[model samples]
Target: MKTKIIYLLMACIFLVSCQNLNRPSGQMTRVERVVSGQTIEIADRSVAVPLLEPIRLIGIQAPDIRQNPWGQEARIQLEKLTLGQEVLLEFDTQEKDGFDRLLAYVWLGGKLINEYMVKEGLALAKPDFPNTKYMERLTNAQEKARLMGLGIWNPNQPMRQTPGEFRSQNLKQ
Candidate 1:
């Protein structure tokens, strides 16, 4: 009976440890590649074959790569901020989107990369439902960028359409 009890306790402990390991929040990972202005791929080393986990920055949207100068510019800016750097990921209410991409607020060197991108006018504040932990911060950053006439907000050369609109239009073409 004592041996069975010991085994049960050990199993309980193992299960608890597994739960913690599976939690996505507060995970520190290295950026393997920058997919776009608001998305990045991180190396998941937990499995034998390392997989690139794509993470979408919560509360922000960037131009599509085909959106002309803006799209390419956003990608380049995001690359400059996160490519090959270690970043901390903080998960929100909904961890993954329908596309299976992890939805997270990425932090690098104490800066929230999502908010920074909006503030720099490289992206827009786009808060999706159930994942708005930093929505206000991102919106404020975008406002500031607009006021400063930066990037997409430039009075002389503003972006013609939002990233969503651009994508939707492109789909029909």
Candidate 2:
């Protein structure tokens, strides 16, 4: 009887651990501020340090702040959508970038913020490997935005270069 009980307990523990492994590693947090079109500062009390954590929205890249109208427009759009809002942060395979910013998919009011930005043409789909969980969704949104000639995709005043390209060029100067 003792051996049977021990085996049963072990089985229960194993099952619980397996379930945890399959669960989505996401957290609920409130947005402290919109850092930019593709980044936001969130309040995460769960962490020991950095009460305000900066999170980079995965699957999209917004124009740099110095990229002129498009950049400012992107930031404004993001602020309107997420400022002071409660968001759910979902992780991909890669959690942090070289800059130590948390990489995540921000979901607010049942909408995926990362995809929304791309769809609105305020940002471009940037598929970084190991974090391509939403690549197809983002790409489709980008295509639709491009077709509609919205925001950065506007033919009359289209963005001259991608944010990455702009940054690289600036670095050379």
Candidate 3:
């Protein structure tokens, strides 16, 4: 009887522990930390939760600090919009990246921060990711920014390189 009781208790604990591991598809959560323009730490609000992984916004690629002024601008903009604020996280078909960061669409009030980044030209639309939930919207925003010469899109400015290119060149050196 004791053995059976122990098994039941273990099962109960396992089930409860799994509850907040993956939030319901469209659940909104508060931001505990903003790691970068593409990532943030979430406040899971459950004691059963493990170490909180920072979430990577699914379809936007922002400049890196190594990109100099542009990278700093993107990070600053993201910080201004998201730090200490509540956001809605929408998970994609793929939950976690190889780095274990949650892949999500971050919504701030009525705006999608991913799209906002592109709209402001602080980031570029990354269509390579499978979850294309807001791809069209993001691409459109990028075009507008390019047309209006916002952020990294100024015609007089040097061509803005994607974050991937920046990293690849760094690796070559």
Candidate 4:
């Protein structure tokens, strides 16, 4: 009987630990670090306990840090907008990326940061990802930014590769 009780107690503990593995979908958190224009480290405050997780912005892919002027500009803009700010995170069907980054739609005040980045021409609409909750909105934003010659959209500017293209070539070693 003691062995059975011990096994039952262990099972209960395992269940609880699994629940804590990821934040519940559609929660609010404070941005503690901007990993890039498309990713951030956020601290969940809904629980009595808080934990930090890196969240990749859904539907948009920003320039990589090594992508030169555009990459640096995107990171700077992300920092300016999100560092130390509160954001609401809305998760899609897939909660995490292969890299273990939480995937979310981030809201700063009323603005959607994912769409904002594409709208501002700092990122590209990532259609390849399966979780495409905001793909249409992001694509529209990218089009508008392109027509307006904003950020990386300027025709006179040097051709800037998408983050995916950059990573595919540079990270292929």
- Best TM-score goes to which candidate? 1
The residue-by-residue lDDT of candidate 3 on 57-171, one tens digit each, is 8888888777877887888888899988978888778888889888899888778889999999888898746788788989999999989999888777744567888889988
lDDT of 2 by residue, 1-173 (tens): 99999999999999999988754448888888887888899877777775888999998999998898988889989999899888889999998998899999999877899999999999999997899988999999999999999999999999999999999999999
**How do the residues 136-159 of candidate 1 rate in per-residue lDDT, one tens digit apiece?**
889899999999999999999899
**Per-model lDDT:** 0.91, 0.91, 0.82, 0.84
Task: Work out the TM-score per prediction.
Answer: 0.84, 0.82, 0.78, 0.78
Q: Which residue runs of candidate 1 sit more than 4 Å off their true CA positions?
A: 1-25
Task: Please give, for residues 16-132, the per-residue lDDT of candidate 4 as tens digits.
Answer: 999886443478778898878788897766678977778999888888888877888998999999999877888887878899998899888778889999999898888736787
Task: State the local distance difference test value for candidate 2.
Answer: 0.91
Q: Once model 1 is optimally superposed onto the true structure by TM-score, how far is the C-alpha of residue 135 displaced, in angstroms?
A: 1.0
Query: After superposition on all CA atoms, how large is the RMSD of candidate 1?
Result: 10.4
Query: Each candidate: RMSD to true structure?
Result: 10.4, 7.9, 13.0, 13.3
